[model samples]
Target: MEGLHHDTIVDGEEDDSPAKKQDSPVEEELVGDVRIEDFSEKQINHSLAPEERVNLYEQMVRIRRFEERSLRSYQQGHIGGFLHLYIGQEAVAVGAVSVMGEDDHVITAYRDHGHALAVGMDMDECMAELYGKKTGCSKGKGGSMHFFAPDKNFWGGHGIVGGQTPLGLGIAYALKFNKKAGSCLCFMGDGATNQGPFYESLNLASLWNLPVVYVIENNGYSMGTAEARHSAGEPLARRGDMFDIDWSVSHGHDMYEVRHTINDALERAHNESRPSVLEIVTYRYRGHSVADPDQTYRSKEEIEEYKKSKDPINLYKEKLIAEGHLTEGSALEIDRLAKEEAEASAEFAQASPLPEPTELMDDIYWETDNPASKTSQGTMFFETP
Candidate 1:
């Protein structure tokens, strides 16, 4: 189950010339000529209740504000380590997670603030984790890259590229074994799509008919390398064809379209025990990490263009206002509240304490008497023979 399938071969590795230049037919169909202008005219589906629309907008705003504050904190030296901001990819996480139930699982890559917030992890704990306080979701041991809330079924924000793919399969298998009415959402970056584990996981998921959806948040670049420079096949979603898994590519800027597509994928996973691949075309406003100078690879004009024309928050706000679900004043109020909340969380993190020395060994092992329970000390307890 862990090994690679024959069909999992890299597209252009054999010839080493260039991958036969071609557009993915599936991507072309799924992502039609829907431009940024279409969002203004796109009617809000009646199925999406008025309250739900507000909630989606609020969640996206909250994530944006939090990431903005996190950047400030990093610059001010309050938060350390590599900081990967989820600034521009808000729609993908919020839209997709909105369709999921409490029982469903979610896991993603290092740039995970949006995923954690979208899945309902507390703002305080997430901010605290970034600040390296003991109050973090991983008790502060895991930094910006590792936010885990098993209680909320958010497995983690893994640091390794494509590492979460296999773990996602294991979760899906467990859910099916227990006959749970839920599925797993395994999210990875465009960079991760090139790794072997991604292909291997897809092979197993399709072979076993596991209840999982592998989402590639194609933000155009893996670190500093753009997708075109790194990925062999342009559309990562088509990789699923090798395993006979249903796959589609979609614009992540539009919340409604993203929500509906993910909802359908989750439905198929939960009821039919099928898996799918979703390549979400999104963007990140900042560099790969806070440390990297994003200007070297791409131009300032490119970033400004995306922020001005295709920002998820701005588009959704306009949509809500156009549909009469929200007013300009009310939308501004939401943004104000989100900013206040994010600031409060940063203050809370600054006031929180660091982990104690004794806590270093905590969560390292499980007691033999009760293997299910976590233990700080790795001590053995057995009766004499």
Candidate 2:
């Protein structure tokens, strides 16, 4: 999706137009008024023990600290290409993934560092990927946008807008085909909702009753364009209604709220093989990429206001402290440890080797990588001529 950061904002497109501007709803949702008290004590997260709740808080802090570390690395020229930080939207990935069952799978767009970590990926391998080292998750090839762990059921870190939606549909279809009670949680940004492929994926998902939950992490702005300017609909999730797919909206700042909303959608998928479109209203502090200037589109005050009230880590930390699940000292210690872990991962990445040129074509072919599994009888690569 880094390529999209450089896209020219065309004057008139199918989903975006001057005529559609009037139809777009107000931008009142960006403030994120939802608080911890909004949710009942014995709500969807009732089953979680005190330790488990504290762990969730710790997870959000880990994501924040890791992203902050990566940003620092990027500024210092240790990382290359576009770096999309998940600084403000930690709750959406961590909270949702927390509720995922063993059979549940996940895939997301290029803003994927948060999801990658939430799914139990090690910090060293992930940071190595960003540094383009041989020890990286994709062996230094995939970079920041293409972390994959099939063993963990985290399919990819796709770099295209809405490109993973169909793949997610296929995963859900396979689950249903194998008669397995599972769901594929496909995530995309607010901008991706306007993409044609996403709509097509929704159509097929609804038609076949595929167990895929489409999660739109609507962080108000799609790249530099705000939600009201990019999309025509009131809430992007309502588009799912046209396909007869179940849909709902939730505030992403609160971990408990995120878990509650996503848990329901996952249950729908698990029990009925149905699809859902969950629009989680979130926010992003940085620009589309680390290189992009945020001040060009939004105000500094707006960003500061969000950081003040809706920061997922701070919100969850205060909630846990209030509940007596954690103390201020413990929370600070957890954050301190997370910062150390991120720094250690960066050191490991710096020490890792670069991929050899000879190894370039090694992993390209399944048959080549596994000679014992080769059954083809033709040249796989072309000559220099």
Top candidate by TM-score: 2
Model 2 stretches with alpha carbons more than 4 Å out: 1-37, 40-43, 383-385
TM-scores of all models?
0.86, 0.90
Most lDDT-accurate candidate? 2
- Tens digits of per-residue lDDT for model 1, 67-132: 999999999999999999999999999999888886689988899999999989999999999998
CA lDDT of every candidate: 0.81, 0.84
> Can you give the lDDT of residue 63 in candidate 1?
97
Task: For residue 224, give model 2's deviation from the true position in Å.
Answer: 0.8
* Error of model 1, residue 86, in angstroms: 0.5
Decoy 2 TM-score against native: 0.90
lDDT per residue, candidate 2, 178-246, as tens digits? 999999999999999999999999999999999999999988888999876798856677789899898
Can you give the lDDT of residue 45 in candidate 1?
A: 36
